[model samples]
Target: MSTYKAPLADIRFALYDVLGAEALFARLGFADASRDIVDAVLDEGARFNETVLAPLNRIGDEVGCVYDKTSGDVTTPPGFKQAYAQYVDGGWAGLTSPIEFGGQGMPHAAGVPLKEMIDAANLAWGNFPLLSHGATEALLHHGEAWQQEVFLKALVDGRWTGTMCLTEPHCGTDLGLLKTRATPNADGSHAVNGTKIFITAGEHDFTDNIVHLVLARLPDAPAGSKGISLFIVPKFKVGKDGVVGERNGVRCGAIEHKMGIHGSATCVINFDDAQGWLIGEPNKGLAAMFTMMNTARLAVGLQGLGLADRAYQNALRYARERLQGRSLSGPKQPDKPADPIIVHPDVRRMLLTQKALTEGGRLLGYHAATLVDVVGHGADEQERQQADALLGFVTPIVKACLTEWGVECTYHALQCFGGHGYIAEHGMEQLARDARITTLYEGTTGIQALDLMGRKVMQLQGAGLRVFLGMIEAFCKEQEGNEALHEFVAPLRAKAGEWQQLTISIGQRAVANADEVGAAAYDYLFYSGYVALAYWWARSVAAAETSSQSDAFKAAKRETARFYFARILPRTQAHAAAIGSGAASLMSMDVTHFGG
Candidate 1:
């Protein structure tokens, strides 16, 4: 099986050197989140993930999760429960949760490295606690004080895991069609009744009680999305004092037997008049749920980044060791019968593709995390609002691009192994399979595209886009005199202008035809993503040139930045051209003529 290791050096460089995360954290009132403390956290997170979780990845995939249909219980693969225990013991669960609720209260950015480590080590196991962040966000933002005391503490301290119950069998993206009902009781609680599908960690052996942030409808509520309400339901009932009580009406009907992340239970949860408490105001569940969804969307982006990094790491190792045909330039390893695959230009292309995407994606994902911190704790209200808008703009790009690139990177990684990658023993296939789901879940790439083009850019009038373009322009101006950065800075500045023009053009066409948004959305998301990476890549090169990093490290950053600009950045051209084509061709085709 291929081994896994956290890319600590690259992670550190991105967080501290490239992003200047420490200074930002200090300025945002995260005084306790000093470089030393955050560094130590990274070290321990790496050790725990690499030693405890990495070894379990193969076993988890192999054994998968076991479900007792009769009892409605799910038993996670062996070693998962133990690793989670270690995680809780180490205080990793509440690393970024509020201090008042039994948490360490670190900056959100500080948790990004730890999250990346967990995902790279074991994504399936990571899914078990993944929704906890969203659950915490939902409760912290919308739940009642008593609900926080009862449910939030357990989830924060890792005494219990959490799940976001959004998708139902009848409705996936359209929550308005959901049939889940929440009937009011005289005791001020609600009885939730309905079935939720694809509920990650819906039922697990790691914790006794699973806190479910469910979406349902009130009896007298209006129709459609606006009428939905959010509720807190648990596997086992609890009281105001926080003591676990009798089992609730909720039960795991079944677990999905499918493509990947087999160790993570994707359960069909049934709430048969389950005891629940209302969260936020009536008919405002969708808005409240966005609090959780926004968190999950960013975390899903990190999942893609982590898996891509893992795939790249293994592919690089294989290219160096797996001897193949001699290079056209002549055998570099004359002592061996044939040269290693790394000597071949085609192999280099694939490797470099993986490297460029993985590294550039790291900066993109981490920068979003930093924005989360700024949105939450910026000193000035205007600064916080601007950060929030920027975060909204990039969230879709980060989610869609990282995931689509995750699938792309893993495919290239497997191809690097030739026939060997297809086999289970090498573990490349599992990574590929696992990467597929990231794009599908947490809102599909298509959903994110519409969100970006239809809502963020057009409806919100490009508030987030303007902020991002300003950053790129300001960066280019700041580094104009630095000749070493001219190669990347010049093109990046031009791309920023093109990005603005592209947005304006799309807005103009959208005024005449509404279908223009859908047609331009997918291409526009990728276009935005590639240009965003261009800015980050430029910044990465500039940061590496002056940092105290090793000579080899510095050179690698510079060369990779060059490779990205030369090969990957041009992908934006294709996307832009496609966007320029307008929506006529797409909408002109009649439904009856689709087969033709």
Candidate 2:
């Protein structure tokens, strides 16, 4: 089975030294998130996830979630409910929620590492509250005052869970194609009738109720996405006093039989005239649902990071212990039947690839997390808006790049385990299966790519891109004189310039032929992602050099940074070439030519 050890030191390095989140939290007026408090939170979170959640991962996968069709009830894998009870008792659910509710009111950055720990240990279990956090984001931002009082606290207090009900049988990524319907009632509420598929945590025995932030259309609504509206549909009825009451009309019709994350209850939910209230203005549900969708997008990004790091831990352990062919240089373990696998250069390559990708991905996620905190609680409107722009620019890159890397890194991890990885006993294959879904869900890489290139870059006129570019430019200038960082800094400087030029070139090509955008969208996203990570890796090396870190630790960071720069960063070259190829190659292919 897989084993997980929280990479606390690297996480701290990314948060404090590399990203400067300490100063960021202080500047944002996060008075409760002092250095001591943050450290304590990280340590405590690591202990819980590594000890309690990690052990249940394989069990959850084996037993999975059980559903009762007769009663429309779902039972989580054994030990899940108890673990969730412990999680609630420990006040973990509201780690980053507002103080007005029953929460710690910590800054979002402080909670990110804690989340990483949970997700790395057990993704299926971690998803339970992830959807809740997204729901709380929607309600806190767009819900009515009475609705906040009635439902938000329950989510914050971990008394109930939540789900983002967006996908229907007919549509997934395209919100305009959704067929869910909402009818006006005599009272203030609406009767929501829809079947939302692929609903994570839609129904579970872990909590008394589940709050579904569902999207449906009203009778008078316009066609397509503009006509959609969001509603707060709870699994159980709640009173004005925030008391749980009778069951609502919503029910889980069935759970999916999927390739992975069996521990998570991915359900087919049927809403039969469920009583729900409008979350935001009519015909503006997509906008309100975005309040939740954006949060979910980032959360899924972290999920990918968590799984990659966990897979690395298990694979690295196996490499050091499992005997194999002699190293090219010499047999390091002379006394053993064969040298350890880690002695081989090929084995080391795979291990280093995992390390480089995992650490870099963590930094990417951490930077985005800090920006989320900034956008929410920065001292001034200007700072918040700028942060929001930068966050929007990087969110797609973070979501797509990290999840894709998760798939790649997990494959490397499993490959290192050889024949044993193919077996279920070692648990390496489960990581592969779990990693597979991260790319496909939340938003597919293709969808994120289009959003990045089409909506944010071209449509917004590179507003977010300019903000991110400015930050990179400033960082590159700062490291100019430092002889030690010159190796890392020089390449980043060139990459930054190229990144901006690439955007301009794409914009020009797109103006002549809109198909240019779609043709280059995926490649452009990857190019942007690699360049973004290159900047982070450069920052990590600079930070490691200045810190009082141990020689071994500093050496590892420097070596990994070098490997990333030399090996991984060049991937941008191929992506750039693809982007430069224009739309002709893609657009010329006729629909009939797609298959024989």
Clashing pairs in 2: none
Residues 276-354 of candidate 1: C-alpha lDDT, one tens digit per residue: 9899999999988999998999999999999999999999999999999999988799999999999999999999999
Tell me the deviation in Å of residue 114 in model 1: 0.7
Candidate 1's error at 319, in angstroms? 0.4
The lDDT values for all models are 0.93, 0.90
Cα shift from native, residue 536, model 2 (Å): 0.6
Kindly list the per-residue Cα lDDT of model 2 for residues 1-596, writing each as its tens digit: 89888898998888888888888888888888888889999898998998899999999999999999899899999999999999999899998999898788998889989888888899999989999999999889988888898899889999989999999998988899988899998877899998999999999999878899999999999999999999988898765567677889999999999999999999999999998888889999887788788888888898889999998998889998999889888878889999889998888889998999999999999889888988887778988888898899889888898889999889999999999999999999998998899898888999999999999999888888888788888988898899988888889889989989999999998889999999999999999998888888888888888887888888888899999999889999999999999999888978999897
Q: Candidate 2: where is the Cα deviation over 4 Å?
A: 241-243
Model 2 vs. true fold: TM: 0.98
Each model's TM-score? 0.99, 0.98
Candidate topping TM-score: 1
